[model samples]
Target: MLSKNLLSEIKEKSDLLNSLKPLSPENQAKLDKKFRLEFNFNSNHLEGNTLTYGETELLLIFDQTEGTHDYREYQEMQAHDVALRMIQEEAAETERPLLENFIRDLNAKILVKPFWKDAITADGQDTRKQIIPGEYKKTPNSVRLSNGEIFSYSAPGDVQKEMAELVAWFNENNGTEDPVLLAALLHYRFVRIHPFDDGNGRTARLLMNYVFAKNNLPLVIIKSAAKKDYLAALNRADTGDLSTFVEYIGNQLLWSLDLSIKAAKGEDIDEDDDLDKELELLKQELNQVPNEFEQEKTYSDVANVMENSIIPLFLELNSKIDKIKDLFVKAECNIQISHVKPNGYHDQLFFTSDDFLFGSSFKAYEIQAAIINFNCTALKKTIRHKDINYTLQIDFDGYNYRISNKFKNEELIILPYKTFLSKHNIDSIVKVVVSYVIDEIKSATNLNI
Candidate 1:
């Protein structure tokens, strides 16, 4: 049972946090980087991502790690950063409501390039299975309890229907509910849905915070050290006991709120208590651990992997996106990837075509990600929904970029990538992205109406 006084204190702290919304851009960047590192480290650590917090810090902040680990670990961590940024950018970029594709994109970002994983079956049998990113589970997914029984989620056939219901429920009740409550509910519900095979927990947390971001609420990052308690809270929520889990999430959120408040006040947030000491100790621990599982991969080896794997994927995506430029040319939309060095960053890094709205130009790596912006009357089309005329808008609305032509954005139907390829085939990904944009354009047309 949570103390009423404690709950009241949380509410008070949250109110104080609400009063401090819109942290200045400079302070926002500082706190954003800090929270991004801490949250990414803790979230991944909870999922058994082998990198230590110090290592995560080194990689994210300095773009290098002090020690070596699995290449997948590095790749996935970077992918997570990208996904986190995607959620943040999508949230900050516009006021569109959440979309299913954004969630799938985030899932894909969790595991940048998917592969197979050996696993345990529901009957306690061992087997091998492929893990597909950016899609719902195709096989049965459940948790094994200590008693050897299974805690099953939505069956493969029911995932889509249930997820649709979940989204509809959220869309209906989200803004009306308390932000913390809504976040906790979203987290618990997603866990129950267990939509994806792996990275469900991480993805759930991301979606939870994505809700918080939508509400202008401080995002919570559960501490890895609190894993035992965290799982216990989740279990409680699983068993129809929700208050405890809500309280747990509330406490975590309160901590984040306090941090934001501190940053808003211009207080030095770099060091508090033994954080510095703890990080140093963590670094020392990482250093002492033998690299027994180390691979013989070098920078050249990584570069080769990127060249053979990631670059081709990017190229394919670029090709698919570029093909759509001419279609938009008739609409007079500016589509360009904003290219810039790491330091002179703008809204987005990718700038491939001219007239990509929300993308500007600068130069750094010639082949790096460029912003895919659509501006200058890209969203000028009007549509009729429920007898009300609306103009289509394709900017990121806190949750997902959708066609905001009417009061509610119409569905942007995108076909799934037809085939799965392990070599990071960009065709499917680029297809989904471009298809979404195309659907946005199609949905805004008055033809059907």
Candidate 2:
């Protein structure tokens, strides 16, 4: 039915029965919203609907339309979304079997009102075909590809038996086949029949997901982006390469399942990651995007904080440190910020003070140690206040923080600036790193204001 490894991976990751068993009804409904919007937008978009995702969201969520689309486009987007939701409701009705009537209802929901559409007839003459919503085609239908070949569906005379056969095959295999295969084959078979006059593709997709939903699996989308591969995969099935389409559907199932998992975990799902280029997707998968873009943005944010805020901070503290340059007491000291290392180098949040003398009883290094120890104490107190789990390692080379009690395979570096900016409203980086160090120094060195 499908690749054993791929199926195994999906089963392992999905664990749908166990994973979904514990979720509350509200959580389930919340999860459905994400699928409904993306599925509706991408599905309609593939069929040449001109609504942007934002516009679709606007119309669906707020009843406020945004785009200059034909009113049919708006109605279809709303209708398509409703069909998806209705299928979910139908799937919930235990007694409702997959049937021609159910499929037509979905198609009718897609068009809302029937109208005539223009098409090229078999003899290559332009003609207007009467479209009765949810009804079978009275005349035959076929697509003329770019190369001028016609890919035809069942003849008008044959659609009835073919559709009956399609429904029976789906119902017979409904609980018997691997669900991903069942869904993909159901779609391929139905599309081959071109059973409805206008909403064949949309109905195929809605039926595809209904198969998954009935099996307690999460729904998957054919991103409009995967259009090329989506069509190619279907064409492959036409020539009897069903595995390619099965894998395509399998991949989409995996993709949606992963997205659902991360979404459930409350992680940010990137919109650009949803589909592939050329945008024809049977909801196949996109590879993992490099974190390079996000990491670069983060680096930029950190750099902005340093340049605009952190540098001036150090210069101000250095000004105060500049004043102490004149006084010569018993011991001279320098304040240096470097990595908490045995003998290493660093990024130069780097500050060092000119020699400043205290009294006879003070050793320079001892005073520095006292300052470091006090800073450590204040850091620990602050960490406790924030409820972070880490320890400060203070030494002559300077201080570093690490997760002392937590363990992970890869090191999790805590860039002080990243932590600073990520918390937002980090007005002063110098206030954080410098204040703790300098305040402790002044107190421990017994320096008066």
Best by lDDT: 1
Q: What lDDT does the true structure give each of the candidates? A: 0.62, 0.60
TM-score for all predictions? 0.60, 0.59
Determine which window of 10 residues in candidate 2 has minimal summed lDDT: 365-374
After the best TM-score superposition of candidate 1, give how far the Cα of residue 366 lies from its true spot, in angstroms: 55
Candidate 2's TM-score: 0.59
Q: Output the lDDT of residue 318, model 1.
A: 47
> Can you tell me which runs of candidate 2 are displaced by over 4 Å?
24-30, 272-449
Off by over 4 Å in 1: 1-7, 18-26, 270-449
TM-score of 1: 0.60
